[model samples]
Target: MIRKGSQILMEVLQEEGVETIFGYPGGVVIDIYDQLAKTDIRHILVRHEQGAVHAADGYARASGKVGVCLVTSGPGATNTVTGIASAYMDSIPLVVITGQVPTHLIGNDAFQEVDIVGITRPCTKHNYLVSSTAELARTVKEAFYLARSGRPGPVLVDIPKDVSNSEAEYRQLKDVKLKSYNPTYQPNIKQLRKVVELIRSAERPVVFAGGGVILSQASQELTEFARKTQIPVTTSLMGLGAFPGSDPLWLGMLGMHGTYRANMSIGACDLLVSIGVRFDDRVTGKTDVFAAQAKIVHIDIDPTSIRKNIPVAIPVVGDCKISLSQLNRLIDEIDLTDVPRKRQDWLGQIERWKGTNPLAYKQCDLIKPQFVVEKLYELTRGEAIITTEVGQNQMWAAQYYHFDRPGHFITSGGLGCMGFGLPAAIGAQVACPDKLVVDIAGDASIQMNIQEMATAVENCLPVKIVILNNNYLGMVRQWQELFYDKRYACTYMNHSPNFVKLAEAYGAVGLKATKPQEVESVLAEGLSLPQPVIMEFEVDKEENVYPMVPAGAPITEMLLA
Candidate 1:
């Protein structure tokens, strides 16, 4: 059948099972928007192009589907760079569609024209510039295929305005075959045997899981492997929900701000089975001293990431779920009867570490940020889909609120973007309308994308916004207090807007809790509301996250509060 490039694009989106798209309309892509209006697919009109990408990212993470976003040329395309970088760093699958100037106007400094493909080349997994309407269908098919395949990352498809206006034969391309690209999903049997041998021989074994486990949907396999081997499990920030936080074998997050037991265990373990993790700087701390005592066995689908950070004893290159399933099957054949008894001493030591320096904050008359997170967790019964803006609020949410399942706790772990939470929560709520979605944000960070409250209100998404109002850029202030002789330069947010009134202005419910006594009541009221809400809590300005490892220091070397 013959169709316009714009119509073909919409049909391809429908073929890809895209129920919604987060985007901003512009002059170049007006044709595409006109076509979109006729489709059943929902388009979330965001305040900023960056929010569109972030909302798509959140939708992808929460729904375990590839996120789709669209924007016009020049600044519209440029604005998505930050969000694209964030998604790239974390391996989120996204297909960003950007409009381009007409083919005839190309390379002549046409109005609203920019080399977005070049700009996003470094950040995206792959990118394309569709030159004609004939290649549009194939290019889009390849774009989505590339976005979700291998080590999933964002992919951009820049369509010229003239292409969308032109007609073409509409062909639904299925089963994209790229001979150059094929991720190894099956693990080598010899490597599995070696890993099994390490598990059986080692008395102190620790299973370190990362975001890859969650991305691969291998949480069940990871949990089962850890349980069957009787090994203690710890995860990177992105790996929060891969293992149930309430499980006996589970240790809290491991890294700079990780729990004492988790940090100490990583440093002291004899065998470290790291899976689906890149051993990022935040998690490794001083790489020289990190896991010095452990003989590491790294398992990841990305071969380059296996030994890039820290040298590994056994490197298995395969998908997380596939590798874990094989490991489970191999272990089933092994003599693992004595595993628990052999690791008693190791488990006991971990318990002692947990008991001595448990994650805690002093109870005070002023509202504590940690207290707010804990209360929010309790009120929600740890079932809410939590997204977070980077800073003290993100760390506090990671530490206090335990996640028992995958896709529940979504945060920008790699890029540490500040304005991520609100838009992400908006997308997550859109993906899971029946679920309670909350954005744990800081006073300073919340303002970054506060305009998204209007998007939520307009969509009737009941996303809860919990702002830890500390009156400062809490993380930077903490670093300054510790290293810069308390010269809090430009960190104090003294002239911040009244968040309650801000939310009200956006046509959303607004609530505030000034004192400790008002925290729970305000939270209850805000949470119970059936509309978007901004619940701001006035917290202690000087409070810092505990068990923080200084930069370049070993993970074990923590500055406890």
Candidate 2:
């Protein structure tokens, strides 16, 4: 018996429990698409290759599964680069399958041919160019394994067109071993002891959780640990909802735009327990001064990330959920109820600084971005799944939106890629059909993925898109305003398309709101639509998100505008 490589690929995916795939069909990968059509696995046909990859990423982030994407070579594979890089930066598990020209056409400048392996080398955890049918099953299995394993990231498999058509005996290789790839989930006893000692001995202890908590499905463990110890917890931007934001012990995001209480708490803690967070510059601010007074205990699945940014007093390399559970069990017997409150007075003093001076805009004739977010929150009560594009809209969404559930807010936090909103909303809608799915995007970012409205209308997905129509690459403009004396060079956009017309063209409902009074009604109408809806808000151009921490400043040193 013989099997096509595409068949083998699909089998491997089924074995890995991939129920959905996001992708576009092209000449090089038509055979795979043919096989895909015959399978039970759901395939989302995106308008653009980039949208397909981001949609997969969103699916992975929202569902905590290994996202799968498929595409052809050359432009198709290249279009997925941004999305791959984005997932890599955020440590999301993604397996991308790209079709290349036939092996015989190598280096001939063949049509639709590109070296996807070379292009994705830096972005992917590992990539394989399958020249032989024998390697297809193992490579795909390894790709999935590497993708979802410790320190998860995107992995690429570039299969040639001929290879997809080639036949090979079906060999089910379970327990395939790779010598160079080893992921350990077990915590070191000595390191765990040191971390426990720190937790027991410290007067002021705080747990800084990151997206890793959600990635590891460790929220339960994280909350239990915090509750048992009565320790304060703070989260990074990507860490929102890792612990209930409304919980008494949980502090919201801690960064330049983070809540003042969260920032102050991180700065003032004597012992900082960082779980599943990489200490990104946004979270750390100035490395030298960031949690300068605190002894850090860094726990993560990726060993390389342990001391990459912040010096660790104790490094626990293991899965966040596993490590936190062990620590919680070991420290249950320690008595810390008598420890004097080291930062009680300091917290009182910082309360004035901890005031929630969130992003604000002047009374607007035009609907403002902040108002838009607030109204959306009011309508949905923050229960809906929210995705955001890059730039000012992303910041505004993060700044104004409050999430009550884990994995409700999905944004490109690490790579901060523009044009991420619409497709991500599509994926979220597909994942949870009952939840209200919205994409909060800037005019610029929205335009980049505007074509995805077709996917929504075609699928009748009922995704609500709120475009912050500032008519500028608003974030870059902010940087120019502050750093470059407001030159506003290429940041400005002009002569925009009537988004309503575009939506109508795509067979979706379209609405526009210029005034604040029109916002709630428009949002209500959009949400009620059975099919997809695009609402463009003519937002105030002058509105700016405040309390920004410049790129390298400590999270404590925020620029309040």
Q: Which structure among the candidates has the greatest lDDT?
A: 1
Give lDDT: candidate 2, residue 70: 96
- Per residue, candidate 1 scores C-alpha lDDT tens digits across 1-561 of 999999999989999999999999999999999999999999999999999999999999999999999999999999999999999999999999999999999899988989999999999999999999999999899888988877899999999999999999987887888889898878888998999998998988899999999999999999999999999999999999999999999989999899999999998999999999999999999999999999999999889898899999999999999999999999999888788889899999999999999999998999999999999999999999999999999999999999999999999999999999999999999999999999999999999998898899999999999999989999999999999999999999889898888898999989999999999999999999999999999999899999999988999999998
Query: For model 2, how does the per-residue alpha-carbon lDDT over 69-187 read when each residue is reduced to its tens digit?
Result: 99989999999999999989988899999999999997999998888899999999999999898889989999988998888999999999988889898888787678987888998
- Tell me how far the alpha carbon of residue 528 in candidate 1 is from the true structure, in angstroms, after superposition: 0.5
Clashes of 2: 2
Enumerate residue pairs that collide in model 2.
Answer: 285-553, 286-554
Q: How many angstroms is residue 337 displaced in model 2 relative to the true structure, after the best TM-score fit?
A: 3.7
- In order, how many clashes per candidate? 0, 2
lDDT of 1: 0.95
- lDDT of model number 2: 0.86
